[model samples]
Target: MSAFDCIDTFITGGTAVIELNRPRQLNALNRKMVSEVVEAMESFDRNEEVQVIVLTGKGHSFSAGADIDEMAEDDPIRLELLNQFADWDRLSLIKKPIIGAVKGFVFGGGFELALCCDLLIAASGTEFSFPEVSLGVMPGAGGTQRLTKLAGRTKALQWLWTGERIPAEDALTHGVINQIVSPELLMEETLKFAAKIAKQPPLSLRLIKDSVNKAVDYPLYEGMQYERKNFYLLFASQDQKEGMNAFVEKRKPEYKGR
Candidate 1:
């Protein structure tokens, strides 16, 4: 167990599950929690044994955003909270995949946290909103840019303007969530998905993720160029030859991440 009370991290089957443990406070993004999470994530990234990561929250909510009650005139407190988003930005550059299993309220920073994942799996009743506008502030995290990129300009504006929560089903329809499982099946399904990803060639997975993300931000020709570059680069790896040989041998490929 970690010395920190705000976050708990455990490793199972090569997957590091990072749980936001501040349940009583709705897993609010506080200074300690943010720092602990960032530390844990960095540790996970450095651990070669950890193949994938799943981030979730304990209790009824995934996260209710920053701890408003902790608001103070101190610059350190504000700076610490801001640093959580910085950690999230670094997550996008991680080689291993990260999956977010969101349930209950994933509002403000919580929603932005989910957006950081390569894949997002939410519970059927998950609720998402950007309520910072109502608080007379904008989303300090990647919510503004990520939301608009994920849900498009019109819908993103609608969500921000209304400050209304969207249900899991609606979020799925709008392309915000990839899958919605029952509350009881949340972790089960998420682990299953993570395991599936873990079985793939690690370098290939990273390259594919990078290519797709680049495609999202680039033009068609530029995206294709990016894909072509990655394709040839991956083909040069030993894993690529192993994958091909395994196919011919009618056996599963054993990727050494070469």
Candidate 2:
């Protein structure tokens, strides 16, 4: 019934969701699937109706990894020519927040996909790993860099070199994830958290996301300057005035996202 081969999308009020649909393969991410995901997120990034996005999988696993069958058949030269990682970079361009609601197996490329999100919440039993080391390769996407940024170099090397599984609790303690819940409550809690974020002024959310990303890539002084510039720019928005004036008037402010 869906137009897409690998994903199903739903827009619910201020939150949009993209659900991986390859349950039979444990939601394996093939080129088709990753392409579809980038396409959908780009559209949502441009859509004013969408305030945030929650990405999840339909079945027991978020994704086992990239499609091994597809990879096994690829010639090395052809793989380099295809350059699938270019699509993954587009995810960083999206200005809105993305919350990954992960459960079960989140392995290799799947683990990298979760790392791409602005925030992550996982079901209790979820396992995160990069088994690419055992496969005689390493993460081609931003896995090594991103994980090392958050979890630091020592832990990142330990996990990457050994191909060990990181459970939800361990991931939380190390800052790989924001929250953990029972499997049944994962989506429910994620949506609730997203809705709370959605109620804030749109421009603030956009700028905040941008500033935080700069923090990851920029030096401390430069990041602070970027943050200050965005802070000064927000005063030009209609929502900023409405928010401040409403507080003085002791009334709820209505935001037009201007």
Candidate 3:
């Protein structure tokens, strides 16, 4: 259990909880925090017992964004840290699903962090925005691309260009978030969702996620081809047969990751 000042990482049953511990700073992302986050993610990725990841921050706010005070000194180290933190390869490639439990302020890097997750469940009172434009910078993470893909190019550009805060309801309606629960219930709801996913066949989940993510980067015909191939491949697995048999028998399916 390696612990860092900025993050608290723990495994509970099938889920890995990554908590941002900088409440006084509203869980702002700094170089140390970014390094800790990557470390925690890597450890969770290697742990077979961990099937899902739930990322959230402490206190009323999720995260206010990057630490502006630290960014005051603009140097190569700062630029490199920014780039490393923004890179999707750090977390998005994990086979297990990652869920973001967002509440309060989710601005700039905080917003980008949620965008990195496979699913985002926000509190009804959560505030979301990409204020990098106002700061004379842009979303360094996959935000620009992910937001556009998730909410459409025009909408994404509108939000980014304006640097305005969006409420949870609008975020959900725009596909920026999956669900909106009460602030107090945000963690519980996210856990419920994670547990539900953890109960499914792990192999199927990983394959489906890969297929969709990869297909999205291709042309329509190519994308459908990948989907068809993935569908047929899964059908050939023992888990697929067991799933159907279990349904017929009215019993829970026991998946062996086959």
Model 1 has an lDDT value of: 0.86
Regions of model 2 farther than 4 Å from truth:
none
Tell me the tens digit of each residue's lDDT in model 3 across 1-258: 645889998877788999999999899988788778877887887787888889999998889998888776688776776676544467777777889999999998888888878899998889999999998888877779889989999889999999999989899999889998988888888888899998888778888888879876998888888888888999888999999999999999898767
Cα error of candidate 2 at position 5, Å:
0.8
For residues 168-187, write the lDDT of model 2, one tens digit per residue: 89999999999999899988
lDDT of 2 at 31: 90
TM per prediction: 0.92, 0.97, 0.91
Question: Which pairs clash in model 2?
Answer: none
Ranking by TM-score: 2, 1, 3
Off by over 4 Å in 1: 72-85
Best by TM-score: 2
Residue-by-residue lDDT tens digits, candidate 1, 1-258: 776788888888978999999898888887677668777877888887888999999999999888776654547576776665566666677777889999999998778777878789999889999998898777876888888898899999999988899889989988988999989999999999998888888888889988999988999999999999999999889999999999999999999888
Query: In angstroms, how far off is 187's CA in candidate 1?
Result: 0.8
